[model samples]
Target: MEFSQLIYRKQRRWNLFAIAAIVSLLLFSSLYLMVGEVFISPFSEVTPLMEQLVLQLRLPRLLTAIAIGASLAVSGAVLQVLLGNVLAEPGVLGISGGASVMMVLVLFFIPVFATPVGFMLAAVVGALLFTLLLVSFAQVARLTTTRLLLVGVALGILSGAVVTWAFYFSDDLSLRQLMYWLMGSVGGASWYHHILTLMLLPVLIWLCFKGQVLDKLMMGETHAKQLGIDVEAVRWKLILAVSVLVGGAVALGGVIGFVGLVVPHLLRLSLGSENRYLLPMSALSGAALLVFADIIARTSLDSAELPLGVVTTSIGAPIFIWMLVKNHDSR
Candidate 1:
């Protein structure tokens, strides 16, 4: 009876936490739409200009933030399970890095393919290729978690080197444009970007609903196989889904880092490690975090906007360092 009561209390707490995360997402999203450079009151008398500004400019950016945030967070959660490493994330695994590298190459060398759709497609393909390579390492090479992480870090370094060379060789105008983008911002978001968001949503929803599969996989391959889970097939499907998600996020937000790494880690700490709850809650929490971060990015300065990546990295880096230290100490 005591054990049953304890389980009930824990379930109630998790339910309440989920409700709070959802509420926070909605609240932050509303605040984001209202509190930009020009504060437009939703309750106030209508102005055509205000409506246009709200609908045309802010709404798309908000949607981009929400979509990219949810995508990256869910991808990270699933990657952690797929890789069997708590530290796994799209950015950390070189998925975002690969997407960014492809985007930069296309923008610089293949000017004809510099359109938004073209960029998204390039990013998706790049992410998919990189994900396949990592999957091979995990499945075929049978690398350990630590070695896999090292390989991922090496891929990220290689991608960074390529980006740096591109930065060095570009003319002044292209340099400035690429610099701003690589730093990351959603300020360029428009109705056109909504197509990318549409591409992301189904994959995000599908991944979120895979919590049971993730839970079984979390127990290791042998255990998952014993439970009638086809580990190899599921991993491939998940890799494809994660590629789409990470690719779309990089295309939408321009190499935003640490969101995928940070949001799920924080949720895991407070909410426990049940993927069923963790995945959806990570989506809500991640969306809220990015929206809040964007609010800071645009509004913090008077004239110039700060890069969205800079703001997120600033917030996430410290938490990530603490996490690293904690993990080491625990060991």
Candidate 2:
């Protein structure tokens, strides 16, 4: 194929992907609104209770899925580009682990700090602290990308230990609550959570879009500096953006892993490495994936909803393994 033809073909493919994502989103929304305790047929009957369930219960959950999905995917895309590592994700980098630890602590030790806003603040602080520690350790050790990954893995293990200890010492009720949160569900979503997520989502999206300078930086930090980009300043801003996005999502929906990891990689494979297309495509695809996963979680079993985390992990693990295998084969 000629170069121009190839370019046109790729753009057409992306357009198709975008259309498919929109269709999936609409189908998921309809399914979410229609499937519940009382199946309300759209044309036949519209009762008050049905309206409550659709509007009050399901709408918030759907919106939360969209927010968490978009936020996590964007975080993953930015981190991967910034670190120059395809495997970099919020969960792998210890940000999610740190947020999870603080959330568990709040649930156990501080009853007054159990509100959504309080939990969000705690998670953001913890994520930022851990991110700083990781950066410091990287600088001290003169780390490579591989070394950084190992360090992040180690930090995640340590944070897991802290979370476990917190759970062990907490009351039974608190422990149960913590366990449910950790499992990850949108069942408890409310309008307040929706509002909070909506407020933060646009700002994070803007920051990620603005940080496309990282694409040039991804070639090498030295090259970026030579081109007049303030490398340190950009890195710190990206870190802050990731903290707010990931921390807010974790605070509201607990730690839903693999959405970040999976979404960005898929986008990169299908759409190439351009951050502009990659970021927005990842957002839409991630939102669609999470909404579909949540629907399966809610409606798959008879009268027993599965945890959203379980659903994502079950689907994500196999995909991740495949990607790893493919990467290995390519080398």
CA lDDT, every prediction?
0.86, 0.80
Looking at model 1, how many pairs of residues clash? 0
Mark the regions of model 2 whose C-alpha exceeds 4 Å error after superposition. Answer: 1-7, 135-147, 172-174, 329-331
Per-candidate RMSD, Å: 1.8, 2.3
Model 2: colliding residue pairs: none
Best by lDDT: 1
lDDT of each residue in 30-69, candidate 2, tens digit only = 8877887677788967778888888899888888998888
Task: Give one digit per residue, the lDDT tens place, for model 1 in 1-331.
Answer: 9999988987887899889888898998899889867898879997998889889999999999998888888888888888777777877778888999999888888989987788888899889988888877987788876688888889888888888888887777966686687777899899998988888888888888899999999888899999999988998899889988988999998888888889888878876888988899889888989999999998999888899989998998898778878877877
For residue 302, model 1's alpha carbon misses the true position, in angstroms, by 0.7
Ten residues in a row with the worst lDDT in model 2? 203-212
Cα deviation of 295, candidate 1, in Å: 0.4
Best by TM-score: 1
